[model samples]
Target: MLKNKKLAVIGVGKLGEALISGLLKRNAVEASDVTGSVAHEPSISRVKERLNINVTLDNCEAIKGKDVILLAVKPQNMDRVLKEISSSVKPDQLVISVAASVTTSFVEERLPDGIPVVRAMPNTPSVINAGMAGLCAGANASEDHKSMAEAIFKCVGETVFVDESLMDGVTALSASGPAYLYVVIESLAEAGVKLGISRETSTLLAAQTMLGSAKMILDSKQHPAMLKDMVTTPAGCTIDGLMELEEGKLRVTLIKAVVKAAERARELVNTQTSKFSK
Candidate 1:
């Protein structure tokens, strides 16, 4: 969808760098078609040198004449960045924001009315093209805008479209899910170490198991429960492990954590809206 498009990424941090790299790696956009806006001299210099793309400290200059503008800045810095570029953003340009708490309305309020906006929650996994991204469009956004958003995200990872209301849940699940997985990996690794496995080997086993399990879910087309049941023979070792997890209320804990995180994401959005209102 971004073929031959002039795109500007208005944050050159790790996520921004990842998106840029993904786009180029996937041939989504050519080097000359991409530009980066960053405040840190080192990041700007490094991205420019590595990608051979345009990089500037000025957000407005970076976005000028761009067909797509990616708002990759931190939530707190969004207002300042928008203020810096609002005057230059063309009315027809599509704005895609990956900011955690910044909603579509939050972004639209900063730009001219009628401009298309898409709010996406893409995880750290996007850095590796294995990420899952949840996307939503503003009231003014057209189908074409949605398609563009999907195309861009699909290049880096899987993309799912949902109502803007569910974005908070998406944020809690996929965007914050990596940290949860990391904790799980660490815990499992520690358990392995306690069971006499070397720390290095335990870490590798934990990571590979995660990778393999994810692949199975994607490839099998079988329900996850079905897959689990297939491994769980009657009175088997797998069943014993499952019993231990059940005793710890693992599923309940995860469900509660997801619910709490979603609520917190909603609170963050409300807070941003409140602060902007004031």
Candidate 2:
């Protein structure tokens, strides 16, 4: 889908860098085919050096003649960036937004009429080529547009399509999920430290275990509960640990955390939409 496609990335920040780097690493697009733009002059050189692509300060210049434009700007800055490039973005080109809580309709309204927009929520794990992205297409986007957008994200990891109404929940779950998992890893490492394990070794053990466990679920294609049961045996230490986790309400706490985050994301979307509507 990306063959011979010229790409533009606005707000070449961390997520932007990770995405562009993933594309280049996967040979999805070449350094010469991508243009990146940053808000500051210093970032121009930084992004250029890192991605080996043309970097510009002008969003309009960066997007000119590009086949796909990826917006990696902050949620609050999305409106400003969209308006800045609205005149230049063509209907033939696809625009993909990774700004959290921003909907495809939110992007479509700010662009030229009938321009295709794909809203995506990708996580930090994309830095390691193991990200998860949730995508939803605007009214103007065709299946081809969606596929092209999916190809870009697949370079980093996996992609899924859902209705726009579920996107904020996707943002809260997958995009915001890494931080939650990190807390779990940290707590596991702390338990190791309390048991006289060195902090460094404990952290490595905890992180690797998490990675392995995740791989098991993916590779086995079994329910997580089934996997958990497999790890528990009659009078096993694993069951004792699971008991402590249940007693501490870890599962419920996690469920509540995701729900709360989703609620906040919805509020932000409502506020942004209200502001634009006004």
Best by TM-score: 2
| Native-referenced Cα lDDT, model 2 | 0.93
Model 1 segments more than 4 A misplaced: none
**179-251: candidate 2 lDDT, tens digit per residue:** 9999999999999999999999999999999999999999999999999999899798999999999999999
Instruction: Score residue 54 of candidate 1 by CA lDDT.
Output: 94
CA lDDT of each candidate?
0.91, 0.93
Compare the candidates by lDDT and give the number of the best one: 2
Compared with the true structure, model 2 gives a TM-score of 0.97
lDDT of 1 by residue, 164-195 (tens): 99999999999999999999999999999999
Clashing pairs in 2: none
What total of clashing residue pairs does each candidate reach? Answer: 0, 0
